[model samples]
Target: MGHLKDMVGANVAELVVVRHGETTWNATDRLQGQAESDLTEEGVKQAQAVASRLAKTAKHISAVYSSDLRRASETARIIADAIGCPNVTEMESLRERHLGNLQGLARAEAHLVEPEAFKASISSDPDESIPGGGESLNQLHLRSKHALENIARNHLGQRVVVISHGAVLRALYVHAKGCQPAGRVRNTSINVFRISASNDWSLSLWGDVNHLQGTNLLRASQRGDEMR
Candidate 1:
């Protein structure tokens, strides 16, 4: 928000989108969706670690954006403070896929409470929304696409950091890259992409957690919930 309009721009825009740090719900095997949860102690450290990595290794950041949820906003604030970016634009479109009645419920509990919704969530058509008020995978993909296109169009030639959730990032990955992520998108993992002047999407990096190389925390099961 700092004279972003005044600065001359370039032909391409770089977006370094990151998933928020781990939360108490994440640790407890609960689905967060659009619900609320705070970061754990390790989550705080993970944010700090990613912030440090961005400060040291990334290009000059022109803006910071975050999902309006607490976890994503908190992570964005940490990274913004570390990198000297003063403003973070929180957008609802950046929020996670709404899990509807399944929100705040752990996997087993969700299956027990809403059997049909649970079944749909795991193996339903992409066009089907979850029970209650949740978004389907197709809905999420479209939202992610539009949000990213808007951001790229608004800030052409600049680099920005977007803090978001797992499902949202997964949507972005699948829609933009045309393939699923190879593994669980780790907490605070940095995924880089660029949008050209012609509005074409290109991937530059994925699941980069070099900041946490010494830690033993990167062993997320390639099999379980990428929607966390």
Candidate 2:
């Protein structure tokens, strides 16, 4: 595999993409879409575990990029420290899908925050933006693809880690797989992919949580809020 990639030279880039560590919102079944949430104690431990996992890979990471959101920036910093990177790049394009007025509310209370939008979001059309400031699924797909392509293009031959949110990660997976949905992504789970010069993405791994085996926090629900 190493030689095969070398054959492509700088035309290919290796990416290690991960969802941010679990947050208070994640723990409470609240919607975190584009909202702020501190990482819980367990979340910090999860980040440490993933950091340790990346430290053992022996790959020279060129950079660490994450969403501007606190949860993701925090996770990226943890990973960057373990990998000896001194800085993290924050990008809003990598943010979770905007959940509009429903953000920060528990699933049970989401309807009350934005009744119509919440109901419409359940089965919104690809182009139909969720009411109350939310983006459409199509918008997310395009943003995910463009954000990843930009990252791969900028890094070229380097290997880098990108920490983002569940919704953004899921959008990437869906876009790469022709919009086919994958399983739920757990906090701190590792995902790997390679991007060709043509901007095509080949997934090498998805939602691997082996590093969290002993943490007893590997499982993540597939519910809508959890996905966000």
Candidate 3:
């Protein structure tokens, strides 16, 4: 889709979104939920790659925001350095879906271990609660929309960089495009969107991983039924 490109100030304010780099839990094929975790060695490198690239292409990124998770925060910090911004402010509302009791289980393990409950959770409607306990799709919808609106209100006329989890970023895309929330969000990939003076949003790209280039970009959940 063509993204909106009008400038509100002397320049247009684009939302440059990057998924947080990978993590030790990710390497172990574990569900990180909203639990805090550190970036893997490769994840750090991936963030650096993104930061390096942004340093070259993106200009006038006046503010940075990130999920409160350590992985996302750390990645945002790297990008901030590249852009010469001080640090990213943490936004808890931008955090990933709270996976509840499935915090550390592999998708396969969770399914086999609690097949009925797992199925119920995944298939839960927007209003229904996830069986094992967690944020429902509807809850995420509310929080993400609120966070973006707040950002747009406060940072009206400047490019902003946001470092967030894969699923959370995907949720933003789905919300902006009015699509069913099933799109893939590659780790450390970038998605671009823009907001207008009238407060409309446009999705420029989604789940892109060109920066990862030659690395194996697979997620443990992708090997399960999560792939679309």
Best by lDDT: 1
- Cα RMSD, model 1: 4.3
lDDT per residue, candidate 1, 1-228, as tens digits?
112232234988888998888788887888878889898777888889889888877767999999999999999999999999999999999998888878888866888898877776776489988888888899888998888888988889788999997888788888668987765778888888788777788877888877777774454212124354
Error of 2 at 12 (Å): 0.6
Instruction: Give the per-residue lDDT of model 3 (tens digit) for 106-159.
Output: 765887876655665586477765566777778877888778767766777777
Q: Taking the candidates one at a time, how many backbone clashes does each contain?
A: 0, 0, 0
Candidate 1 clash figure, as a count: 0
Q: Superposing all C-alpha atoms, what RMSD in Å does each candidate have to the true structure? A: 4.3, 2.8, 3.5
Candidate structures ordered by lDDT, highest first = 1, 2, 3
- For each candidate in the order shown, give its overall lDDT on alpha carbons: 0.81, 0.79, 0.72
TM-score of each: 0.91, 0.91, 0.86
Candidate 1 displacement at residue 206 in angstroms: 0.4
| Model 2: lDDT of residue 17 | 94
Query: Candidate 3: minimum summed lDDT over ten consecutive residues — where?
Result: 219-228
Displacement of the residue 141 alpha carbon in candidate 1, Å: 0.5
Candidate 1 vs candidate 3: the TM-score winner is 1
